[model samples]
Target: MKKRTDQFYLVREDMLSEAMLKTIKAKMLLENGKFNKINEVVKEVDLSRSAFYKYKDGIFPFHTMVKEKIITLSIHLEDRSGALSKLLSLIAQTGANVLTINQTIPLQGRATITLSIETAAMTADVTVLLGKIEELDAVVKVELIGSGA
Candidate 1:
């Protein structure tokens, strides 16, 4: 038998089944207080109560996955204009939200940058994102500083 692991797989919205999507919508309605009862939520979302119950504890909205995850990265960058801008733009394109940024003065044509990102809405996993970041011409190195659950 294959070993079992405790991990959640992140899937694109388009890949979700219609019933699963409805369950998410119903849960959202209830969580946001738009509906006071499960029946009302199910009716509005076009989901059956049985289906909602089945998926309610198994699935979560995208933001819920990263609500407590914060990844810090230490990057060495070349000292030049548009370097940081390009980096930030790439990150944005990947759907990661930048939580904080710290930079030290450049010396020897290299600068150190530390950035914390919330990966809840990120399009890719940390490893993949870091690889993409390191591919930038301005980036000398990218290291994962830390991650918190």
Candidate 2:
């Protein structure tokens, strides 16, 4: 007998096949009330019903995974003046409420910050926010440590 276990990956959109991408589009059309029927959604996105069904249960947009949930992030940052303030400001711009924040004392010009945030009111996808954070000059690294209710 063989056992099967589910696995997941965070793949970039461009890496997905055309059919998989179209499947995502079809699913979105149905979700946003733009189309009620799967047939309509498949036609709108130029994907066949079979292809849509094949990938529908497998592919999902990144935002859907974190919506209405609380997530924890571990950030490594340079100990530059106002770096922490700037980071918090960026997070606020995304509409994610900061539930709690803990910071380690700067050692050798670097610090670690752990943040718990509520994503229910976020204005954009969590991945977008993380990308923006990664672009910051003072940020060393950002990791999604955990997520839950």
Cα lDDT of candidate 2 equals 0.90
Candidate 2 clash total?
0
Q: What is the lDDT of residue 125 in candidate 2?
A: 88
Give Cα-based local distance difference scores for all models: 0.87, 0.90
Best by TM-score: 2
Candidate 2 lDDT trough over 10 residues, lowest sum: 1-10
Scored by lDDT, model 1 comes in at 0.87
1-149 in candidate 2: lDDT tens per residue? Answer: 86745787899999999999999888888888999999888888888999988888878998787664799999999999999999999999999889999999999999999999998888888889899999999999999988899
Candidate 1 Cα misplacement greater than 4 A, ranges: 1-5, 73-79, 85-114, 117-149
Candidate whose lDDT is highest: 2
Model 1 error, position 120 (Å): 13
